[model samples]
Target: MKGQDYYIPAAAMAIALVFKLPALRNNWRDPLLRSVCVLLTLAGAVFTFAAPPTIDAVNEWTGIPNFSAPLVYCLMTAFSASCLVLMFNWRGGPAEEIRATSRRWISGYATVVVAIMVLFALGDAPEQRLRDFDTFYANTPYIRVMIAAYLLAHNVAAMTMVAMCWRWSLQVRGWLRGGLVIIVAGYAFSLTYDATKMSAVVARWLGHNLDDLSTYVAPPLASAGALISAVGFVLPLVCQRTSDSWQTWSTYRRLGTLWHEVQSTAPAGTPGVRMSWWSPAEIRVIQRESDIHDGFLRLGPCFDRRHRDAAYEEALAHGADEETARAVADAAMVAAAVRTSAADPEGTAAEDPGEGERVLIMADGPRDLVRISHALRHSPVVAATRRRATTADG
Candidate 1:
């Protein structure tokens, strides 16, 4: 392939690696994260070293004809091993079992890499064939063995990944399943790459020439497959994180209505705890909820069960569902309490619930808080009750 084709993918992988580095540094013991980083590193190296311009440069710089051949082959072998190790870690089983399996794959591929280098050193390739080295030396003793060895290793890894990901996809759902399916498709392309390269090599062994398949057809397939596989590996992680962030921010926004209403009634100089601008959405939400509950506590003496009961009956009479009616009633009570607390800042005139009346404002969690916020913003019963409380206070 051309320099741009190879370098572009290399650059992309480098960017992906950079994004993962912080997480990897913090959780270096995490095998899955390590596997991902290693896979990206090896994949990028394979593309960079296999480019025709890079191959020619390495040969010239090293003063050895076709020295780039074994270098690229060993890189490809390690890349294949990284893919298998990543899949094993990603599938997840007993921790020990995962570790053992990954180690075995790494050891085996390391052996393959050593063997490729040994074969290349023993074989004589006096003529440098930058792009067509595999097919050009397909019948030259140890060179032929090296070519078959790398292709076989690559094919085995591709087939194994396709099978594993396909089976695992069936057992999962959502984005994970989609990612696995895409990974399977990517490895399918990898298999096609192996097929084309092997076809050219085998044809050369049989006194025929199909060098075009190896020289022209296989590199693109390899590049496309690697790119697709990288996307598949990344899709589920990026999408899930995005989904979580969106939900947290939505919660923070929805709670704004209730927080604002209660905050206005808090004592002067006690404006609740203010969060820094750089806080995460989750931390911001926690702070808002804390402030809201503090407001509810300050307004507790102002709560009157009678106001809630009247609003609840009004909401039910107007065809609201039970859950919504409860929310409306609670919102009405809170709205009236805000005005009562304002009218009697000393809280001496505040009335408690009767013997059997239950206080629900502080009983539940964030879900109830969101419902009350919705009711405060939208319920007519809550609005009317607030108006009546204002009139009475005046």
Candidate 2:
């Protein structure tokens, strides 16, 4: 019988419409994202129990009186609009693109939702509740058959959702993608759950009704969990970006350090400025400064003074006595100068996550690196050594 089925479908309805909302349509980075996701969860929950019809009949597990059409639609609808508002208002997409791809997701899901609700609402016509999965599945094929179409279609859609998630898993970095891959695997496993039920003979062999274990209830629970887990894919991306944004200063410091490092590296031909040229003592200091101020600049300039002081203290500790301390202090100053320069493209400090000092020679013509080598050959130290060796030979 058509019952509380509409609530789940209705939620899908609200989210689909939200996809088209002006606010969420354009903005992706808005801060209210978690709230929106929570609403989605609520909507999913409402859909679950609501779709099952209420019956005065005793449930196998609860032995409690069950009521048909679970009153989910009416009760959940009361909050659906508000939930939609919350969802549509949160942010996660480029302004040019819809903030969340979930908007489109809801829209597609809504087709089934609307059909399920409409069927449930219509099936209850004559102002009476009709209770039977058989009637709903088979008899309705005579009417608009919208519900039937949606049910089978949902299977396909579920498969498609898993496929999309699978494809996305290939593109992103980190374990987030792998986590999503697991989620998609769950959906895949779920799709096969119904069809692979134990045969009646097998059920007898196993001392259980396959239907008892293979009830309609379990899949939805698992599916919902899978959907929620799939949502984690978005979280890491959000947090990592936020954390990175917060570290702009540290990133700047890193780049600044790299510049000084490059300077200290000196040209390769002339005992060059690379870390390789520095005594082990010097490289240790540069690396230490790089580690300390890693992402500090992203928070903007109005930061606490204590951080700067902390950095100074850190430098001193690493300096490890007079000469090294002097060297460390010089390294820190060079990095600080880079932080102030704002010469980095778009004020981003270093392009790489870990920046080091090195001279990159870009040449349009013949080997330019060799020219520096030739110049190094004629330097005072080399020339004087050559003369001394020649006098000894003579």
- Model 1 regions lying over 4 Å from their true place: 271-274, 309-322, 351-365
lDDT of 1: 0.90
Cα lDDT tens digits, model 1, 1-394, are: 6899999999999999999899899999998889889988988898899888999999999999999999999998999999899889888899999989989999999999999999999998999998899988999999999999999999999999999999899999999999999999999899999999999999999999999999999999999999889888878877877898998899889999999999999768874566788889989988889888988888777888889999999999999999999999999999998998888888766653342243548537778899999999999999999999999877
Worst 10 residues of 1 by lDDT: 351-360
lDDT (Cα, tens digit) per residue for candidate 2, span 286-358: 4534433332233122122232333345545644444333333333333333332333325344343333342
Which candidate should be chosen as best, given TM-score against the real structure?
1
Hey, what RMSD does candidate 2 come out at? 17.3
Q: Pick the lDDT winner.
A: 1
Cα distance off (Å), candidate 2, residue 230: 4.5
Candidate 1 steric clashes = 0
Q: What total of clashing residue pairs does each candidate reach?
A: 0, 31
